[model samples]
Target: MSHVANIMLSVDPDDRPTVESLSRWLQTSAPLRGHGPGATGRVGPLGGTTGEDTRRGDGGFPERDVYAGALDHADLDELIAHVERLAWRQPEFVHLFVTDQEQSSFRVWRFHGPKLRQISPEGREEEVRPAGGPPDIHTRFALAGDVELLRDMVVAAVNWGPGPAAPREAVLSDPRNAHYVDGWPRPGDLGLVALATREVDRWEPAPVGAAWLRHFTEDDPGYGFVGDDVPELSIGVDAAQRGRGTGTALIRRLLRTAREAGIERVSLSVGRDNPAVGLYTREGFRLHGRDEGEDSLTMVVHLR
Candidate 1:
């Protein structure tokens, strides 16, 4: 059975970029079927494969429309020839966005670092799997409200590299540990927990944990404080979830969130012992400074 992914877009009436346009924002250009002459760049309005309107918001200012379409199943070799083949692209995610809508834009979230299986409203499943994709799993997201949950994540992030178990009981007592979840859901604070419900009766969490950012003033800066304008990033997944490319998904989603929030960059501090440093490097974090006598490194990801 085919499962459909829905995409919503806000577009201006003129020269809007759509799936049909094949604008290739991050990926390069390729021949696409849905584009036509004299048609504004949007789904149905252009040509070829198009999206059906599930919901249409008022046409007044920032007109928004809900669109649902089938998952493209072009073979990976052919797909990669035209696009960069991002790690976050997956079988279950709807990667559609208003590629270049004039005067308006929406944040596009990547939900499929590990290709996920979807249960449609009609209960059908997406049958095609990408050639080298990860095992199919059901994905979930939630707010990091519970401090206990935040604490577990805190321990994970602090002890990221391969080594002895870092003390969890008194982890938060240290100023360094407190920096990550200290303000715990402060105003403008954002967090997203990753969960999977494939193997167990309930959602098993921490596979690729949450990515969080907190902005602090000079009066009280976190250990990784870059500036008042840049949010500091703290992320850690359970030991069970390491090395599966799940961390990449979490970081990209956090980057999307930061972009949506108008943040220019996000920063973090990590030690030399951490293996996960490569993950941040792959996601575009640059070394900004060193902490703790060269034992730790400070990094930042520019959103703008």
Candidate 2:
């Protein structure tokens, strides 16, 4: 079988040097790193089919130009790092897609946005490290100690309160709050956390994010609660580490955890104003309904 990585690189009109330098680098380096053809392989973008025109000016990005092409999975990250070094600003627009065409699937390694495959260039394959890389985190089961960690993540979820978040004390005040995080990681409750370190992980050496499910009941439904079987999800990334791909990593890991646990579906409630809605949508969560308050929307993802 064949596995191809189709990348879409874009930047604003009056772009920065990181972008210009990236264009220059790709012009020279892609040829060196790419395989199978002269330029990009046959899957190059032709028209609007590849989401080339999907531009949103919400996050401070005004306009964008796309660099779309397909390459072997091996060359994907080098191209992505070129985009990521420009992303520290968390600008409104910077998008990329690394797609596997065989499954009609693609993962946005950066959309100003959000990794895998090594970062080796053609010859000195082992020398270079991943650029704009995945956070140095490992996924692990939620331990009993995660209660405190979950408390912080809950605050992190709502931009750390003083505004949109619910009272922190209330979220973890009682056992009835189990749907969210009061008594997290219950019997059927599967959770995964992203652990990192200051010295090695580029951040604090601690658990920074988590994704877990709690099967809710008819009388005690979660905010995004659907039913008893469809466990509601509560996921949050560290406030200090929002834009650097930690959220994406945690979700991907939790999805794998869900599949292994024989889970059939998961649900979550997200606010319309949350930036994470983009991340959740990208990771396959879809709309179910809006809350009575209308400030939030319920989303669900079916696991296979």
TM-score of each: 0.54, 0.52
Candidate 1 lDDT tens digits, 130-221: 12223432222335455567778888877766678679977878876786676577776876555432334222222346667778778888
- Clashing residue pair totals per candidate (backbone < 3 A): 0, 6
Off by over 4 Å in 2: 1-133, 160-167, 174-179, 200-204, 290-293
Report the C-alpha displacement of residue 180, candidate 1, in angstroms: 2.2
Q: In candidate 2, what are the lDDT values of residues 185-273, reduced to their tens digit?
A: 56787776666534433223367787777788888777888888898888788777778887776777677568767998889888877
lDDT (C-alpha, whole model) for all candidates: 0.51, 0.60
Top-lDDT structure, candidate number: 2
Per-residue lDDT for 291 in model 2? Answer: 56
Cα RMSD to the true fold for all candidates: 13.7, 18.0
Off by over 4 Å in 1: 1-144, 201-208, 290-293
